[model samples]
Target: MKNPFRLPRRASLSRPWRWLVPLLLVLLFLAVLIWLPWQARQMEANERQEQLIADTLWVEQTLRFELARSEEALAVLGADLVSKPPTPEQLQARLNQMFKNGHELRRVLWLGADGAVLAHHGLELPPAGLAKVGRETLEMARLTRAGRYTEPYGASAHAPGMVDYYLPLFKRGEYAGSLVASYSLKVLLDETVPWWFAQDNDLALLDRDDHPIAERADGGPGRGIYTHRRALDLPGSSIVLATDSVKGTPRLLPNLLVGSVIVLALGLLLSLMTLWRHISRTLAAEAALRQQMAFRTAMENSLLTGLRARDLEGRVTYVNKAFCQMVGLSAEELVGKKPPMPYWAPEAMKDYEERFAGVLAGTITPQFETVFQRSDGVRVPVLVFEAPLVDSRGRQTGWMSSILDITDRKRA
Candidate 1:
């Protein structure tokens, strides 16, 4: 009889190609899930550092501007004091005029030829020993005789909370005793320090000696002005400002284990899906084959026969209808079950296993025949043919086998 079993006529689809597509997609999905979040956190930290640098530069500029303005106002007042040594009434008038100009001078001092407090404004005339302390203020004013802004002097007898600006007065280019303007730190804060209050910042003006002579802020020791070197010349005072730091979100390892598991799950799912599609199409094709095979069986089924189809593992995957009928078992009962060694003809088991192993190893193609035993203890002959089952990449996976019952030819 012509061979009843045959290969599918046209390549309906490449089964191996179908399975590989999903495997690659699953790997791609895992790569994206892990990489995106880590990059975002690195970007946020860099932005915070830049903003802190900008705020510090703003404070340093404001301090320099206010100091320059104070020195200029003191120079104008100093010129008048030395040009005229006036009556007591005239000295009081000049002091009142300076105060009315909205400057924060707490005391005005006039030094004599021998550095004595010859006349002063805004101080009680102290007794002899007490009034002698104004000599230090005269010594500071002596430095400005050459005409430049003098540094701050610590509080003298009459004024304790103050910084001084001294200027030498001249008439006809002749040397004269100096005029000194004493500034109240409180008035300086009231005029210039309010502008720094926004953005939670505190500003302090310190003397060259690092004593805090003026402050526009209250509370907290956030005071480390020297920590930022740009504020160094603003001397004695430290400026500190802070904002609530942006809280970082918790980082979960979204892509580490989760990505790997997801990829694996997808791979398994794709594999299963491919397997299901494969099995489904194979079953449909097999059903069509069964119809054609049924007619051949009807012509040949009268004599009892044995059939077995094995994979490369020597486990049976299919059985013909005639063989199923002879064993009195359904095809499901025989599939995936191993054939008994004793039922096989002598020496067939070794040959079958070796051939199946060769097919699995890709060392040989598979197609052969051997005797088989039926459920009724009948020795019957069968023919089996196998082909290498592989992926599109041509890697061998398993084998597909078909069996034909050949008992009638043997019996006849």
Candidate 2:
């Protein structure tokens, strides 16, 4: 009989790709884990820069609007001076009203063409203080004969960092004098910078030389990590509005959310791979067991020896095909049959019964000769080998026998 438990010769033991695919997937997840945070930070930086530019432009436009309104006020004053020059008391009253209405303006002055101060409000500058106007400012006023702003100047006892807006006055197209409006940089910034913007950033007004004329008082100097500056479109002045972030830029929350998702996805993938591997191993083991059982069944079916099994109670429990043919009986008729069986020869029945009793009591010889009466009444000689049928725990549960026909050998 063939050995039923032999393994197939060509079966492979190694499966490289099984582990390699999971390794590659892990690598891909790690790449995403590293790359996604950086991408999110880049996007955040871009958005911050755009916001800075927008804020700078807004400051510039706001400053320009305030200056334009101031200039218009000065133009109206200039027109009134050209039409009907007011008494000192009347002029002082008008200047006080103008000062109350214009919170950013430090002082308003009416100067004679000879550069002498005729009247002023909001500051008690001495008559000699009118000479503080620079040569460039005087020259520009003389040439343009139009309203224009002057270069920024350092803070004085009366005003903190100042710039002067001059509207050249004319009587019948003849250059008459100048109506001057001096703006306090501190006051201008306090009014121009929006409250919302001041909450998150430090804004400063800079002069042509990049000197800060005014800055927000709410915080100390900014870190300058995110800074933006833009020029204000004011005539005869090179003023810049600059802004800096007061605190570090915040990280995007979505990046954290995305990172968590990536981690979860990686875990899910690894878990699925593990489950698949376990299932694959289970299936492979099941297939191998099924194949082994099939091989054993085939080997048993092809055997020429008659095989039989008897329970501890001495009743026939199993018989192979050869056993049925040898006795001239079908397996259904032989199985479950007790001793004094149909195939037992009448003359040898007592000897067979004694041997069976000895076998059940574990004292019979392992090999012996026996005789059975066939269906045609012929006595067949046989040689039988007996062994214990053991269960998985190695406890004997029954007796097994392999019988070989020895009638021909005896006849020869």
lDDT of 2 by residue, 1-412 (tens): 2222334454333366756776687778778776777787788888888888888788789888888877887788789998899888988888888778778888887888887788878777754574455546866877888777888886544546888888888999888888888888888888878887887778888887787887784766678888998888788888888899776765644556776877787787778778877877876886788787677767777898999888787888888778878889887888888887899999998889899789768776799998988887888899999888898999988898999999889999
Q: What TM-score number comes out for model 1?
A: 0.42
Q: Give every collision pair in model 2.
A: none
Q: Relative to the true structure, how large is the alpha-carbon lDDT of every model?
A: 0.54, 0.80
Model 1 residue 367 CA deviation in Å: 29
- Highest TM-score: give the candidate number: 2
Candidate 2 Cα outliers beyond 4 Å, as residue runs: 1-26, 126-133, 155-160, 217-220, 252-256, 265-412
C-alpha RMSD values across all candidates? 16.4, 6.8
Error of 1 at 323 (Å): 9.7
